[model samples]
Target chain A: MIAAPDSPGLVGPVVLSMKMAHRTHGEGATAVHALRGVDLEVRLGELVAVMGPSGSGKSTLLNLAGGLDTPTQGTVTLAGAELSAMDPRARARVRRRSVGYVFQDFNLIPALTAAENVSLPRELDGVGTRPAREEALVAMAEIGIEDLADRFPDELSGGQQQRIAIARALVGPRRMVLADEPTGALDSAAGEDVMRVLRARVDRGAGGLLVTHEPRFAAWADRTVFLRDGMVVDTTGGASGPESLLAGGGRHRGDR
Target chain B: MSIRHGIIALLAEQDMHGYQLKVEFERRTGGTWPVNIGQIYTTVQRLVRDGLVLPAPGERSDDRADVERFTLTDAGRAQATVWWSTPVERGAPARDELAIKLALAVTAPGVDVRDVVQAQRTESMRALHDFTRLKAAQPQTDDLGADLAWSLVLDHLVFDAEAEVRWLDHVEARVARASLHPRPSPRPTDDPAAGGAGGGRARRRSGAPPPGGRRR
Candidate 1:
C-alpha cells in the first residue's frame, strides 16, 4: 500500500478522477509498471472507455478507479473523496456505497437467485433485507429485467445474466459503475444489448468507466482513451488526454 | 450488396421510379452510401435490356424516362431472393490501398512507418467516432424490425472502421518488433543510388501515387 496525502482539488460533479496515478508491480530489476502516472476523470453522466492493446494498463486503471487497488503515486478520487488517502475500512465502505462493479463475466453468485445477488451489495452496506430487495427490483426494472429477478444465474441466458449484472451494478446508492469488458462474453447482438443498458444507465447520471478493446463497445462511451506502453497516447472526443501534452502546446481539443 | 442488387431488392417490395429508387436505397441503408441518379438510371436501363425489369404503363423505352416507374419481372424477383438468402461473399480479400500503403512503408526509406500507422489510426478512429455519434442520434425504437436495415447498415460502417483501427495497431506492433533487427538478406544491388549518388539522399518518393494510379 502507498501512503496518500490529501491534496486540494475540485473534482466537482466528476464521479472519479485519477491524477498522475501510477501502479507498479514487484520491484527492482523485474518491476512492471502497469500504469505510469495517468490522469483521468469520469464526470457525472459520462461514460469513458479505456482502449488499448494487450498489457496497456486498461485493467489496472479500472481497479484503481474502483478503489480495488491503490496508486503508487497520485490521487484517486471517487465520489469527491480521495481513495488513496482513506484507510482500508473507509475505502471499503466508500467502494460499497458509491462504486458498483461489472466484470467481463457476469460474476453473479451461483447459489443466490438474481434478486438476492443484486440485493447483496445493499445488504452488505447495512440496509435492511426488505429495503435491499426493493432496491434490487427497482434496479432490475430499470434494466427491463424485473421478470427474471427470481431465477438463478445458471438458468438465464448470457445476455439476461449480464443485464442482471448491470442492474446489480446500478442498484441502491451507487453513483458510479466500473465495467471491464462488460460485453466480452456475449455475441454481437447480445453485446449490443449489454452496451445499450450500460449507456442508458450512464445517460441517467451514473458515471461509467468501461474498459474494452472492442471499438463497437468503446463507441458506447462519450469518449475514448488510448494507452500505449503504459501511457496515455491519444483520446477521441471529450477527453483532455495526455496526448495533447505529449504533442507539445496545449491546443483546445474542441478544435482537433 | 452492390448497388445493382440493392436496387433489385428494393424493387421487389414495390414498383418505384428512378428518383424514388435512389431515395429508398439511401433511406434503407441510412444514407451512408449515396448513389447518383444517373448511375441508377443507367443500371435500370441495363436491367430492362436484360429483361429483369420493364418500364410500367406508357413510359418511354429509353433510360431518359426517369419518371417511368419500373416493375421487377420474375427474373428480378428471383435475383432478389438470392440476394436475401445468400450471405455476402467475404472470403476473397478486396483491393485495399491502406494494406498496400503499409506494405510499402515498412520497406521504404525516408518514411516512419509508425507515423504512417498512427496517422491512419487517427483517421479511422475519427470516422468510427463520427459514426458512433450519428448512431446515438438515430432512433432505436422498439419496432426494430422496421429499423433493422438502417441500424445494420450504420453498424457496418462502424465495424469496418473499427477493424481498420485494430489492423493498424497490429501492424504497428509487428513493425516495431521486426524493425528491432536489421534485415538478414542482401540489399538490392541496383547501383544507381548505392554509392551515394550526388552525395545526398536522392531517394525516390516513399509513398506517392505515380502517374495513372487509381485516384479514388
Candidate 2:
C-alpha cells in the first residue's frame, strides 16, 4: 500500500521524475542497496541515457521510473500522476496509458503481424481493430518503416524488427518509452538505424530513458547519467534541455 | 597525415592555389585538421620539385610567392591512385600517457589508483558528453555526403571516449578485486641463509596492497 499526500502534480515539460529514491533488496545484514538516494528527470522531447557499471542499479532505477516496481523510499511521478500513491490496479492502468517499454529482446508475439504487434496496445485500450491498424500504420510511417507492416517479426531483419517495436512504443497515448538496450543483438549499422528511428520518434514530442552501455548509442541521448556503487556520480550534456540538477544530479566536469 | 597526397587528391578534382588547397583540405576533413598556408606551399613545392606537381597552364605570376595554381602531374595522379588503393598503416602500439600513468599509479606507493581512475573517467566522460553535444547540435541535412563529412572524427572521438570509460571501469573492478584479496604475503624465510621478509616482498607482485586488511 502507498500513502498519498496532496500529490503535487507532476509539472512542466518533464514527463518523469524520481526524488530521493532508494531501492534496497532485503533487510539487516543481508540487505543490498540497489539505488542509494538519487534523483533524475526525463522531459518531453528528450532522450536521457542511463550508464553505469554492472551492479550500479541502472535497471532498478528504470523499473521504478516505468512503474513496474515501486521504490523503497521516494515517489515516481509519471504523466501528472504519483505512482507511489496508486494501487496496483491503478498503477497498471496508468502504465498502459502513459509509458511504453521496449526491451533488450524484440519481445514480439510470433503469431502477430508487425502491424498487429504495434496495434495490439491500441486494441487493448478498446479501440476498433481497423482504426487501430490505421493508427499503427501512421506510427510505422513516422519511423520510416510502414513498408514492413504486413510482415511478421520473423520476416524482418533485426533492425527492421526493432523499428516495428519502436512503432509499437509510439502507437498508444504513451508519454515515454523506457527502452532497455533496445539495440541488443544488433550490429553497429543496424544499431545506429534503430537509434535514428528512436531519436526521431522521441523528437516527435515523446520522452525516452535509454539504458545502454554503448557510447555510440548513449551519444544520441540528451544527457547521460553515470552511476556507481548505487549512487549517481556524474551526468553529462543535456545543455539545451531542462535543468535536471534539482536533486542529487551532479554536473561534474574538468578535474573535479 | 600526408599533406602532399591530400594536395594531390584535391588537385585531382581541379587546379587549386595554396590557399584554396588549404581551404579544401580543412573542409574535407570537417576542420579537424587545420593546415597553415605555409605548410601547404611547402608541401606543394616539394611535390613540384619531385616532378609530381606542376603549375596550371593558364596560371602565371611574376613572383614565385604570388598566387600560382598547382596541378597534379601524371606521376602525381598515379601516386594518388596508389594511395587510394592502399591501406593506412597502423604501426606497433605507441606509448599512451594514460596507460603509463595508471600503470605507475597502481604500483606507486602512497597512491590511490581507484581515485586516479575515477578522476580520469570523469574527464573522459565529460569529453564524450561534449562530443555528443557537438554531434547532436548539427541539424542533419539532406545531403548525405555533407552530413557524413561534417565532422568525421566527432563520432570517432565519442567512441574512443566511451571506450576509455569502459576501460576505466574495468580497471576499477580489477583494483577492487585486488584490494579484497591482498596477495598472500610470502612467508618469512625460515632458514637464516635466506634474506629477510623484505627481500621476498620486494620481489612479490607490484601494487598488490592488502585491501581491507586493516582491522579494528
Candidate 3:
C-alpha cells in the first residue's frame, strides 16, 4: 500500500511541478519572456542555489516557487499540494502556512520590535499573541540574537536586521524558505554569518531555494543550478567545491 | 618549498641538528608540508659541501646518526640575507593542470568544458573549506612566530583557491560569449597593421563595445 500524498512519510520534494512553465510580461512585441520552460524541484532538508546573471529568471523562479506568482503554463506544487489548483484564499493559506521568504532588503516593519516582527505571522495564522511572542523569542534565540527581541528594526545593524528577518521567516512551522540574494547588502563576514544561519536552518529539515550571483554564497548550498536566458543551463549537483577550479591537490610540495 | 633557504634561515637563529631542523621547518609551516629525514640530511650535506654550512664540533660522522648539528657560516648568512632581499622570480609560469585541461576541453571534440570547470570548482571549494577550517582552528597569538608563519601559508592557500574559482567563472563566461558570437577567422594574407585597424571597426559594427562598456 502507498502512503497518502500528504502523509509525513510520503517524502516527496517540498517544492515541485514546474514543467515547461513560462512567465511573460507585457503584450505583443513588447512582451518579455522572463522565464521559459523552467522545471525545478527542491527536496526537504536540501538547499538549492539558483545562480545566473541579472534578469536570467532567478527571481521569477523564486517567485513562482514561493507562490507569489503563478506560472503561465504547467503547475507548481508546494508540500505536495498543487498551488494552481487551489482557490485564491486556499492558496494564500498554503503560502502563509508553508512558505517563508528572506529578502535582500530584510523586509521588516519599522514599528514592530524584533519579537513582534517575528511573531506577526504566527499571530496572523490564528496563534495566540503570547504563544506567538514566545515562539518569536525562541526563533530569535536560535539565530543568536534573543537580546534584540525588544529592539525595533531601526536599532539593529543590517546583519542584525537580516538575521531578524530570517528569524521571522523561520518562526512558524514553515518548511520551504526562499532567499533572494539574502546577503546582497551585507559585508563578507556578516554575509557568511547569514549563510551559516541559513544552512543550519535548512539542515534542521526545511527545504530552501537561494537566488544569488556570488559563487562563494552559492557554495553554501547543497546544489547549485545555473540559469541562462530563462532556462537551466547547468547544475553542479552540489559538488562545486571552491578548490576544484584550481589545478593541484590541497598539499603544497616542499623539499627538504 | 625552498627547503635549502628555509634551513639556512632557521640556522640563522641557532645551530640545530638535522632532526631538529626538520621539526622546526614542519613546526613553522604548521605541518602543511612535511620534509623527509633523508631529504633533510641530503640538503644539509650539500650545504656543508658548498661551505654555506659547517658541521658543529663533537658531532658523529655516521650518516644515520642524529647528533650531527650544523650552523650557517658567514657566507651562508650573507646568502640568507640576499634571499630575503631579492624578490621571487616570476618569469617562468608554473605548469597549471587546470589551465591545460580547460584549454584542451575547449578545443577537444565532444568534451564539455563547463563540466570540467564545474568538477574542478567542486574540488577547489572543498580544499578551500578545509584550509579555512584549519586556519580558523589555529591559535592567534602575537608572540608565536610559528603561528604567524603557518597563518601566512594558510592565507596563501586560501587566496590561491579563491583566485582559481574566480578564473573558472571568467572561463565559463568567456566560453559562453565566444560560442554566442564566433570570432572571424584570421586572413592569412592580411597585413598586420591593416588587420589591427580593421578589427576595431569590425568590433564597432558587431555592436560589441569596448571593455568596461554597458554591453558587458
Candidate 4:
C-alpha cells in the first residue's frame, strides 16, 4: 500500500500534520467502489467524529486516514511525510511514533494484568520492561484505573477493561489516536465517562478520530462528518455550528 | 414517550382496567401487535407512581391485584400529546447477519456448499412454522387498527421467510450442478485454495508491517 517516494525538498518541517485529499476506489463488474472522493485535513488539538450506516465506508476512510488501509489512488500525508509513499518498515515507525488506537472490543491481552497490557504498546516499540511498567502505571492513574493495574482482564468489568485499553493506547510516543466504536459496548453511563476522557485528550492538544454508529457519541466531537454510500455526505462544526449543519435531524448535540 | 406515555395515551379518552387496556390496544392495532399483559400492568403501575393516572373511585386498592380502573390526569393528557407530536430517529433497516456470514462461509476450504444451504433452509423453515402458528392463534376482533396492522406484519414475515427458503433451494441445486462440472482454480481473494497467500496484502499496504514481520 505505502511506497515511500523520494522526499520532496524545500519545505522546512511542514507542521500542519495529516491531510488526505480526493481519494477514490473501484474496479470492474464485481468491483464495489467503496469511497468516491474524500478530502480531510487534521491539525493538532482537534477531535472529529465519523458517523455513517453499516456499509457507508466510514471505516474505509478511517483505515486510509490512520494508515491501516490505502487509497486506490490519492495522496495521504502525515507530518510532512507522504504516508502513501513510504516503504512498509518506515510506515510502521511513523505509526508507532505518531498514532494510538482504541478498539470497540478493548483489544487487551486477556492473559495479562492491566499494567502488563498497558505496557504492551511501548514494549512493542522496543521500550524496555521496567520503564514501560512505570509509564503504564502513570497512564492507568490518569484514566482512574491505577488501583486495577494488577487485575487480569477477566477480573474487571467491561468499563474498567475499556479504561485499561484507553490507558494502553495513550501510554506511548503517540500524538494522535484513532478509536473505532470505542463506546459501542458500554452502557450509557460508562460510555459517557469514556467520552469525557477522550474529550480531555483532545483538549490537551492530541487530535482524535472516532468512528461510531450512535448519534449521542457524535455529540461530543469538536466536529462531525457523516458519510453515505462511500461519500462525505455532510460536515458539522467547521465555520458553522452543529445546529445549522446537522439540522437535517439525523444527529445533534446532546447540549440541545 | 416511555411505556407510561403509551398507556396514558390509551387512557386519555376514558378509564380502563388492565385487561380492558390490553384488549383495546390490541383491538386498535388490528390484532397485529400482541401486547403482553405483564407490560400493560407494568406501564399502569408506573403511570400510577408518576401520578399520570389514578385508580377509579371504587377500584381495587391492593397493589398486587390488576388495576381494575384507572383514569388519566391532565398531566397525563399533556404527556400523551408529547408522545404523539415528537418524532424519533429510526435505526438502520434490519439486514440479515446470517446471510452475510453464510455468503462468506462458502469461501472457506473444506466447507461443503450443500451443507450450508441445508442448514440455512432448515432454520428459515422453523422460523416460518413459528410465524404460521402465531397467525393461526390471533385474537378475533373487529378493531380496525388492530386488524390491519397485524395482518401487514404477518404478511411480510411470511413472505420474507418463504423467499429465503426458495433462495436456499436454488443455491443448493446450483452448487450440485457445479460440483458435477470440472472445477477451476479459485481467484486468490475469493478462492479457498489461495487461502493465506492473498490475505494480508491490503492490510500491509494500508500501513506499516506489524512487528517481527507480522502483518496487521
Candidate 5:
C-alpha cells in the first residue's frame, strides 16, 4: 500500500521527465491527442512497467519517453538531455548509444547466426569485426547462450531466437533498455525464463522500461505505473518484489 | 513458454520424475503458477517425444513403473541455455478482472455484491481445503519443495481471499452506517450506446446464478 508521493522538488537520481501540454497528430478536430499533460519521472536503475487498457496512449507515452517520437508541446528530458529539442541525427545517435530496444517479435535477422546477430549492433557503430564478435560471445554467454552462436534464427526455436534478440539488444553499450511485449510470443514457461533474464539485467545496474499486458511479467518490475486515457493514473511504489505488485493491483481503488 | 524448457531446466540440474518436476516448477514461481498432475505427465510425454528428455533405465523397477526418472540430452542443455537468454518486453499489467468486478459492483444498482463475495470465498476455501488434504496425504519421503510450494500457494490464495472479503465487508458497513437504501426506479428501455433500429440484445438476460450451487 506504499504509494509514490507526487512532489516536484523531490526527484529520483535518474529522473525521466515529460512536462506539460499536448501531443497531437492531425489538424483540428481529427487530431489524436496521444499525451495530455504527462508529468512523470522514473528513478535511476529502476525497472518500471507502463500499463493501461488498449488505446490509452501507453505506447505513445513509451515512444515519447524513449525519444522514438516527438511531442507537439512539452519536453522529454532523459538524464538532463532534452530529447524533444535534439536534431534527427543527434536523436538517432542518442537512441542508439543510450537506449536498447527489445521488440516482441524477436526481430532477429533470419539469415544471420546467433553470434552474428548480437555482433551487428556494435559493427554498425564502427567497432572492429573480431572485437565485436568477441563481445557478442561474452554477452551470449552471460544470458546462457554461448553454445548457440553458430545457429541461424530459423534453425533455432522461438525461445532461442527470442533469447538471441535479447542478447542483441544488450550487446552494445547502452544505459537504458526499452522492451515492447518481450514475452507476448512465448508461452507461460518460456515467458518466465525471459523475465528472469530481464531481472538479472536489472540486478547488474541496468535500468529498463517494459510495456506489457501481462501481470506476471509486470510483477518482476521495481514499479508498476498505471495509465488511463493518456494520463498516468497510479504508480505502485518502487519495491522490487512480485507479491506487492500483483496484490496491489487487485486492491486498486478503481475510483481514479 | 514451453514446458520443454521447464523439463530441461529441471533435468539439467538433476534427474527427476514427472511429479518432482511439477513440484520444482511451482517452487521456482513462488507457487503463483499451478501445474496439475495431468499437466505434468502430459508435458513429460511431450518432452520425451521431442527427445529432450528420456528415461533413466533401471532407476526404478516394479510398483514404481509410474515413477520413471527422466534426464536431459545434450541438445536439451543447449536449448535451455538459449531459453535462459531470451529477451522479453516489459509492459504494464493488463485488464484486472478483480478491479473491474469491484468497480462494477460498487457503481451498479441491484448488483448483489454479497453473492460475488460469497462465491469467491467459497471457491478459495475449497482450494485451500484441497491443498491441505493433498499435503496431509503426501508421503513423508516426498521432496521438501512439494510440501513448501503447496503451502505458499495456499497462503497466497487464503490471504488474497481474506483481503477481498474484508473489502466487501467494509463496503457493506459503509452502506449500513449511512442507512442508504436507494429508492427503486423504473428500468430503462433503450440501450445506452445504441444509435437506432431494434437496439442491442435479442433477449433480456437476468444476471442471476443457477439453482443448486456455485460453478467454477
Candidate 6:
C-alpha cells in the first residue's frame, strides 16, 4: 500500500485530474458515447493503467486527459489548471509544456539520432539547443542508454528504441506521461524493460497513464481501471496487488 | 524429479562428497529447490547401487564418512550428457490442485465458478509479486551460469502466474457469455466491431484500425 506523499508544493491530491468527464461523437441518431461521466485522479508518483477490451473508450479517456481532445460534458484539470476552460492555443501550450506522450509505435524520427530525437521536443518548446541537448543526454543516461545517444533509431534494437522513446517523453519538466501500449512492439523481456523505465519515472514523482492489453504489463501500475461500454466497470485501487482483486466482487459496476 | 539427473550432472563435473553435492546443487539452482542431506545420501546410495557412481580412489568405504567423495562412472557420464541434450518430458500433464479445483467447481452444485476463479487469480498474483520481490533481492553475480539458471527459474514462475491469470479471465468471460445465453451457441459475429452494441459504439469512436496488424 504505497501512497503518494502529500507535498506542500502541490495544490491537492491529484496531479492530472478529471471530473465527471463525458465525450460524445456525432449528432442525433449516430451519437456514440466514447466516455461516460468518468472521474479519475492520478496523483504524483502514481502510474495508473487503463485496461479494457478493444474500443472500450480507453484511448478517448487518455485523449481528453492529455488535452488532445476535449470532453463534451465535464472538465479536465492538469497540474491545477483547468484544461477544458483553456483556449486551444493555451491548451496546446500546456500539452507541450506539462504532458508527455508515448505512442504504441516507436515514433522516433529516422533521420535524427537518439539524442536529437529526445532533444527535438525541448527545442520545439523554445529551449536553447545546447541546454536541450544536455537535457536529452541526461534523460538518456537515466534510462541507461547514454551510450546510444549518437546512434540512429535504426541502429538500435526494439528495446533500445523504446528506451529512447521513453527518454524523449521524459526529456523536459513534464509532470504527466501518457503511454498507449508502449510495450506492444516488444518481447516479454524488452517489454519488462520499458515497464521498468516507466515505473521508475513515475516513482520519481511523475504521474503516468499506461494503456495496455496485457495484464502483466498492467500489474506494474499503481492501480488499474477496467473500462467496458464507455464506463469504468472495475477499479483495482492504490496498488495493483492480488489482494485488491479479492477485496471486491466481480464488476463493482460503479464510477470511481 | 530432476534431483537424480542434477546430482549425476554435478558428479560429472568433479568428484564431490554428499555435503558438497547438496551445496553445489543449491548454489547452481539459486536455492529454489533445497536438497536435504538425507535426500542427498539416499540419492547417492541409489546412484551407487545403479553403478552410475563409484567411490573415488583413496576414499574410505564407510557410508557415514564426510571425506569420502564419489565420482561418475562411464555410464553416469553418458547419462548426464544425454540429460543435457534431451528435453524434459511433458506428455503427461501434471496434476495441479488449482486446475482440479476449477474443474470440480464448474460441475459442482451451489458453487460459484466466478468466485473460485477470483480466489485463484488473487493467490496466483500474490505468488507472482513474491517471486518478483525475491528476484529483485538476488545480488547480481559474475557467475553467468548460476545467474542465468536463477533467472530462468524466476521467469518460469512469472510466466506461469501470468498464464494462470489469463486462463482465469478466459473462464470468467466464458461463464459470463454462457449466463447471457442460457443455451450456448457459436458466436454470431466474426467482426469484433459488430460483435455487440458496445462493440459498435467502440468502432464508431475510433475509426483508426484496431490494435492488430502489428507483429506480436
What does each candidate score in C-alpha RMSD?
Answer: 9.8, 9.2, 7.7, 19.6, 16.2, 10.2
**Among all candidates shown, the one with the greatest DockQ:** 2
Interface RMSD of 2: 11.4
**In model 5, which regions exceed 4 Å deviation?**
A1-15, A237-256, B1-216
Tell me the spans in candidate 2 whose CA falls farther than 4 Å from its real position: A1-12, A240-256, B12-14, B64-66, B73-75, B92-95, B108-111, B137-144, B184-216
How far does residue A248 in candidate 4 sit from its true spot (Å)?
19
The docking quality of candidate 4, as DockQ, is: 0.02
Which ten residues in a row are the worst by lDDT in model 1 chain B? Answer: B207-216
lDDT for model 3, please: 0.76
Compare candidates 1 and 3 on TM-score and give the better one.
Answer: 1
Candidate 1, residues B1-216, lDDT tens digits: the string is 358888899899999999999999877765545778999999998999999998876766665676789999999999999989998766656667788899778877778998898777766765566556656655675575537776786677678777788788777776776677656533445666656555424544333233342111
Q: Provide chain B TM-scores across all predictions.
A: 0.74, 0.80, 0.78, 0.51, 0.42, 0.78
The local distance difference test score of model 6 is 0.77
lDDT string for model 1 (A1-256, tens) is: 1111111122238889999999999999999999998999888778888888788898889889999999989999999889999999999888988988898899999999999999999999889999999999999988789999899999999999999988898899898999988888999888988888887777776898999878778877777898877888877755323232212322111111
Number of the candidate with higher TM-score, 1 or 6:
1
For residues A8-115, what per-residue lDDT tens digits would candidate 3 score against the true structure? 112335555576778888889999998888888887767778877777899899888888888877788988888867887888988998888899999999999999
Docking class of 6: incorrect
Q: Please give, for residues A83-198, the per-residue lDDT of candidate 2 as tens digits.
A: 98899999988889888888878889989999999999999989999999998998889888898888988988999888888889879688789999999779976887788778
Q: How many residue pairs clash in each candidate?
A: 0, 0, 15, 12, 14, 0
Model 1 pairs in collision: none
What's model 4's lDDT at A193?
67
> What is the C-alpha DockQ of each candidate?
0.17, 0.21, 0.18, 0.02, 0.03, 0.09
Q: Chain A only: TM-score of every candidate?
A: 0.86, 0.87, 0.85, 0.81, 0.83, 0.87
Query: What lDDT score belongs to each candidate, Candidate 1 first?
Result: 0.80, 0.79, 0.76, 0.66, 0.66, 0.77
lDDT of 4 by residue, A1-256 (tens): 1121111112223222333344455556767767777776665566677765566788787777777666666677765567788887887777777777899999889899999999988898889999999999988887678999899999988888888887887786665778999998898657756876776555555667889765445545655676666877566534322222112322111211
Candidate 4 lDDT over residue span B166-192, tens digit each: 566556544555567635534445545
Interface RMSD of each: 12.3, 11.4, 9.8, 23.6, 18.2, 12.1
